[model samples]
Target: MLISFAMRRILLPVLITTGLAALLMAAACSTAPQPLEKKSEPTFDEGEYGGEPLPGTEQVTIVEPSPGGDRFALIRRRTPGEPSDPRFQLWIVDRDGSNPRLISVNTHDVAWHPSGDRAVVTVAIGIDFYVYTIDLETMETTQWTGKESQRLSFPVVSMAGWFRDGHRLLVFANQKAYQQPFPRGLYVIDTRDSMTTGPLVKLFSTTCLGNQDRYTVGKKYVRSDDPSSGNFARYDFDDESWRWITDFPKDSLRFVQKPVPSPTSDLIIQARETGNAKQLFLMNHRGKDVRQITEFGGDIPVWSSDGSYVTFRRDVHRGEGARYVPFKFNLKTRKAEPLWPVSPDSVPDFPDLSTQTLDKLKPRR
Candidate 1:
């Protein structure tokens, strides 16, 4: 009897201690931090052209998305089998790849109006290019620039963007005067009245930040100034003057290009070269708080209309000649994701082509 009581007392304490240890371990594990579940990358199928497989000789490039993010503009080029002029086609489609329609043929460049109801397209004939406005609702096109003889003579003309009011178009052209050297400058044309074109600046190699009142123009060539340096300025439409924003330095190593302002006009995104690779950077409008955004290397970083996202072309293969894949970066999440499929074979197949026929397409005037 004495031995049995002694054994029971020892066994009870041991069982109690063992149970407490397991309970403590379970509590710790339940309260501990858990690893985050990895998210699968979003997949987008290759887009079709008029519900048909994209030809091998055709290349499609996404230009810009509308302000409302409902529609986007793209450029399609068809390379000829023989050595002849390649065909350029401009297309506009919804974000979901619906309502794919041809806007114009032989279009050089295009920019969407802020209202997303129209687009400004540049058409080239021979050596001359003219700007025209297309009403998306009516599909009626109007030549914003006057007749060929009265229009400014420039070997190249590009549509920049619309002013804050969306009534005027900002353009960049090369002005070739009689018996004088050609000069490239930025000019603004009133859409309501195309006859009124006002010169904004007299600088070469200039580019405007779409949806913003700012532009980056090449600096005056001085003996001491670096030949690659450029100037960023903001245009005041009220007074028709430019206010200097900052200077983008050019050196033996890096060349700055495409300084685009965010939709809110508080941030700017630009590309800079380090060694042989180009990377994207984000900075304030005043040229402060500069920080690198990408490390793999990207170019042509264009902000979304709402400033919520940025789309850029990422160099996937360095050995290849400028081979690129498109990606989107979310500002809120600070994450980069693939925007579209990299390979042409991965493009999604269309279910029905009955409604999407090229016969209904109209030619550009």
Candidate 2:
């Protein structure tokens, strides 16, 4: 089942508006504006927001760690203010909380290449969203998709993950409003084959594992809108088939999301709701040896490079809104702890690269 979280819904609309404004301004100007004599790197004032800050919280969702585990990519958001326009920013930082650099501005989702030399980012350009590959070494970006990915209305494109061979990407696209004839589903794009363009080849209608090309996981829905009758199933890419894995009681309302496999093992972690709230569960590749790993509620679980631990966000309800706190769980010890110590005064410093900096580090074509 595709669970639309509150954060995604809140950020997409705001960023799409900003993208549309940019497009309008570009179209209105007949002549290109003169280049600025001095273009400094973009920077944010530390003390710009001087008053009592808004009650809402800031969060960092870990996308993926580098193959070496020395660096990781994440999306950071600070809501309840105008400066928060463009909703989210993609950041890359060291494991020790050092050398934090802002790679993409106003991007919601990111997927790292297995080689750790580049990352694919999803950003709104106007009424449509597209994916671009950013070179981590030179900080140069290349738009990977074009007219083929566009929809009649709001088209949302998400970078699921890279294929095991790192030659193709698993992408998911759907119109904000469904169109009967238009197709909406998961697809795999050949990263190396530039001649092959347009909406990628649709593989299935639900989510799947990134690196494992052989098997894809999604819900088997009996009805169009109802999920209570659904059961988890795995799709075989080789044979082009799906096999049911789990079937809960029909009377119970169960929802599943983010069924990710461990980096080094056959273990898989997923979130499901069989009770009041969604909780994390651990199971083998075949969906056996099912075990509950979290009780206080968590979602979007990502495994470390070593696959020894999993990190997820825990939602805490405040007065009007909610705050997502990050936590890490150890598989061996079966213990959970706060990912980072709480600091009321701490503010993250996001790195900004100047045009000159990017030009100096531009990758060779």
lDDT of 2 by residue, 1-365 (tens): 22245422321111223332232233223333332233442222232211233365566655456767777687776434446344566778776446677676667677678788988877765556666788888787766544443331234556666766777766665443354333445566676764333333332334536323566665555554553555666666677666666655454333456467665555667876533345677665567656665655677787775665777866544223346666777655466766654433222344433321322212221
TM-scores, all models, native as reference: 0.66, 0.66
Clashing residue pairs in candidate 2 (N, C-alpha, C atoms within 3 angstroms): none
What are the Cα lDDT values of the candidates?
A: 0.54, 0.56
Among all candidates shown, the one with the greatest lDDT: 2
TM-score for predicted model 1 compared with the true structure: 0.66
Q: Which ten residues in a row have the lowest lDDT in candidate 2?
A: 356-365
Q: Write the per-residue lDDT of candidate 1 for residues 104-155, one digit (tens) a residue.
A: 6677777778888988887776566667788877877866543544344443
Q: Indicate the worst ten consecutive residues by lDDT in candidate 1.
A: 44-53
In the predicted model 1, the residue pairs found to clash are 46-347
Candidate 1 — which residues are off by over 4 angstroms? Answer: 1-62, 77-87, 146-156, 175-184, 204-206, 209-230, 238-254, 341-365
The alpha-carbon deviation from the true structure for residue 254 of candidate 2, after best TM-score superposition, in angstroms, is 7.7
